[model samples]
Target: MKRNLLILITAAALLISGCATGPTVTRTASDEVIDLSGRWNDTDSRLTAEAMVSSMLSGGWLERFSTDEGRPPVVIVGSVRNKSSEHIDAETFIKDIERELINSGRVTFVAAGAARDELRDEREDQQSNATQSTAAALAAETGADYMMQGVITSQTDAIQGKRATLYKVDMELIGLENNQKVWIDTKEIKKLVEQKKNSW
Candidate 1:
């Protein structure tokens, strides 16, 4: 009984100390560069997508397609396979790429995956619930001329208390009609993380 009582008292004291000296939390600007883990993060995803899409827009494929079709090519963001060892959210990356593509005004963006399915479901629902003029017509959806897909891969090297990580993202634009790879670009981010000795 005495040992159990001592253990309980010790645990309570540790918990109270933890609560008393807990870490600080504060809100900062969203775009602020904070690398707590030196892993793949939102900043990396957004910046990489912006750079790659900018390069893709300047590719010869865009000019070729424009000359042949006389319109901005309708593009869709396809899957970005995450083959990295670390758990990374690919949807956030995809959205980042889509935003850059749409904002650039160099291509027509089409809905894909869940968003596309929801749109179709709404269209079908409107057929019965909405007036004829208000209902979105069927077969009016724009087909994507090119599909952009990619893969995110990473490598890590560690020795003693030092570690280095390299992440690569490769994206390709493929002609939907012919399965031809029209453009490809790669972006890389490298970080060296050092574990500091406990100051206390």
Candidate 2:
């Protein structure tokens, strides 16, 4: 009788342990689109970058600048302010845009903000320790003719188990020397999620 009781308890403990374990995890491709939380995601960033860059390149801004200067215009990516309800990493989106811009070869991109500061620090370090010819010169950094800035805003609505979210990203290009607004654009994304409530 005691042996049977011990066997029953062991089985029950094993079952409870199995139940307490969390859900399984599986690795997927980085580019695969997966929407588990209905929040802004990698797919949204990539799509926005592609759309914005495509529009910017095909528009009159590049041609006009190249016509006037006879060379590709230099551009710097500035702060992309996130005024959304959820915490969003703006750098990932900005880097995506920068990558597309650089790959296009129509615009020259220069490091800005923290990246520029880090580069300057590295140069300073090299000036002290590295060989003279290998050390980079100060004040020789490329100047950006245009600065890109933007803001992201979001709205969310929920009713029972249904939820909807809308995200809007607005961007602008300004001439650094003349302080003129040269180009502006906006991209938007919407998501709908339906969840079932536990009835127990």
Candidate 3:
């Protein structure tokens, strides 16, 4: 009974100390602020966005828009192939590019098949007695002129008890009407970490 009482007292004291100190808040070692770190598999999405932006400008996509009588180009987020070992949300990257392009006022976003369905439904409801017809009804709904698609790949290498990770993201925009690829983009990002030794 005495030993049990002493053990309970020790446990209580340790718990009190732990509560007072609280848990440590670990911070990333590198000075560079990156997207959420850890073994997340969504790295390709970010890389894809970066590559598309660079390629769009370098591939003269904006020039094409200007040549088309200043009519903003329409883009649709298409399938982004995740060929990596892990699954990732590629739509997030597509959405990011779409958001940026729309905000730039140089491009217009064409709703995807799902969005088109909802838009048509809304237009039908308003067609009965509306003060004004929607833009969708006024003109032939222009389908997306360009579709964005991509693939993600990865590689792992180890040396001197350390491991390095490499990620390659490739994307392209193809003209829908003419079946010609208008833009091609690629981005690569890598990270390395050393293995930790066990403490004695």
Candidate 4:
């Protein structure tokens, strides 16, 4: 009976202590650089997209396509495969790439993937449900002249609580009509983290 009472007292004390020092929450700015776990993060994605797309736009393909096609080339983001072991969100990276492409003003950006299909569905619904003047015409979608696709790869090494990881983002822009690779670029980011000696 005495031992059972002691266990109950100890459990209650521990629970109370835990509640007294519970975790705190604080909000931070979106652009703040906070690397808590040394994983593939937003900063890496944004930087990679900015550098790679800038270089891609400056390539000879842009001038050649503009001259041959007599207009700014339309581009669409295809797929950004995350081959890294980490569970990185590829869509976020793809958005970053699309943003850079659109903001550059050097190329015409077109929608791709399911979003394109969603637009088509909406157009079809409009044609059936709305007036001819209000409905958007079918088969008017502008096809992309070039498609960008790529993969993300990573390597990690650790020794004595010290860990370093290197991520490589390789991307390529290909001519949609010819399936020819017009521009290819690779950007790399490395991070190092050390585990605290007293994990407790």
Among all candidates shown, the one with the greatest lDDT: 1
Which of the two, 2 or 3, has more lDDT?
2
TM-score of 2: 0.87
Better of 1 and 4 by TM-score: 1
Candidate 4 per-residue C-alpha lDDT over 127-180 given as tens digits, one digit per residue, 9 for 90 to 100: 889999999999998989999999999999887778889999999999898999
**Which 10-residue window in model 4 sums to the lowest lDDT?**
191-200
* Each model's total of backbone clashes: 0, 0, 0, 0
lDDT ranking from best to worst?
Answer: 1, 4, 2, 3
lDDT of 1: 0.94
Model 1 TM-score? 0.87
TM-scores of the models, in the order given = 0.87, 0.87, 0.68, 0.87
lDDT of 3 by residue, 83-179 (tens): 7655566667667666656666667778775677887887777776565644336446777778877787777776765666787778788889897
Candidate 4, residue 45: CA error in Å? 1.0
Give candidate 4's TM-score.
0.87
Q: List RMSD in Å for every model shown.
A: 4.8, 3.2, 5.4, 4.2
Taken over the whole model, the C-alpha lDDT of each candidate is 0.94, 0.91, 0.69, 0.92
lDDT of 2 by residue, 1-200 (tens): 99999999999999999889687999999889998888998999899989888877887888999999999999999999999999989999999999999999999999988989999999999999999999999889999999989999999988878888999999889999999988899999999888898111
Question: Model 3 clash pairs?
Answer: none
- What C-alpha lDDT does candidate 2 achieve relative to the native structure? 0.91
- Evaluated at residue 142, the lDDT of candidate 4 is 91
What is candidate 3's local distance difference test score? 0.69
Ten contiguous residues with the weakest lDDT in model 1? 191-200
